[model samples]
Target: MNLPGHFHQAQYPKRARWFMAIVWALITVKCGVVWWAMPHWNMPTHPIWVVGPTLIFATLVTILWLAHREE
Candidate 1:
């Protein structure tokens, strides 16, 4: 059986796209720093606990953004 999907043509503003890209890049860099520094610090919490969600969300958003059609 084929299910109907709602597909709307949307255009993301250039400024917004650039802003999001910068934000995502910053988050990724922060995560990387945390990953590297976790071993040096005597922190109780694991690095994954702090960085995993951010990375996952950023990755998902990036993927969705890339998949979007710009026309």
Candidate 2:
């Protein structure tokens, strides 16, 4: 039997989705590490130290997400 129309459309390719999922997992882990280390790293004196990595990762995640979005 034929599938429903909505099921016919493709989503992100399997490889792309897996790659993004891996990246997302890594990002989350990195963020957790940063959160855990911020106190001992002497980064509290400069806010940029905290924000910089976060902004960089956020931008990367955004780019990856947009790249895989359906057009």
Candidate 3:
């Protein structure tokens, strides 16, 4: 028996995966550096400063992953 219709899945290239990996790595490193610098620079330690970007980044990555996901 066969299904009623044909379905096409989205394709994600190896290069795209590598690019995203690098992007996430860089973001992680940047966050670490920011945390390391905050105290040394005598900057104000506000929760929003760190958490806001992190949440936004997470949301963006989730959207990107879902958009490129295979059906």
> TM-scores, in order shown?
0.61, 0.53, 0.63
Judging by lDDT against the true structure, name the best candidate: 1
Residue-level lDDT of model 3, residues 1-71, one tens digit each, is: 22324333335567866887788787777777777787778887854598578859776874656455333
Question: When superposed on Cα atoms, how far off is each prediction in RMSD?
Answer: 5.9, 7.6, 7.2
Name the runs in model 1 displaced over 4 angstroms.
Answer: 1-10, 59-71
Give the clashing residue pairs of candidate 2, or none: none
Go through the candidates in order and give each one's C-alpha lDDT: 0.76, 0.63, 0.66
Residue 42 C-alpha lDDT in model 3: 82
Taking the candidates one at a time, how many backbone clashes does each contain?
0, 0, 0
lDDT tens per residue, model 1, 1-71: 22225433345577877898799789989999998888778788889988999889888876676566644
Q: How many backbone clashes does candidate 2 have?
A: 0
Can you list the residue pairs that collide in candidate 3? none
TM-score of 1: 0.61
Determine the C-alpha RMSD for candidate 1 after optimal superposition of all C-alphas: 5.9
Off by over 4 Å in 2: 1-9, 45-71
The lDDT-based order of candidates, best leading, equals 1, 3, 2
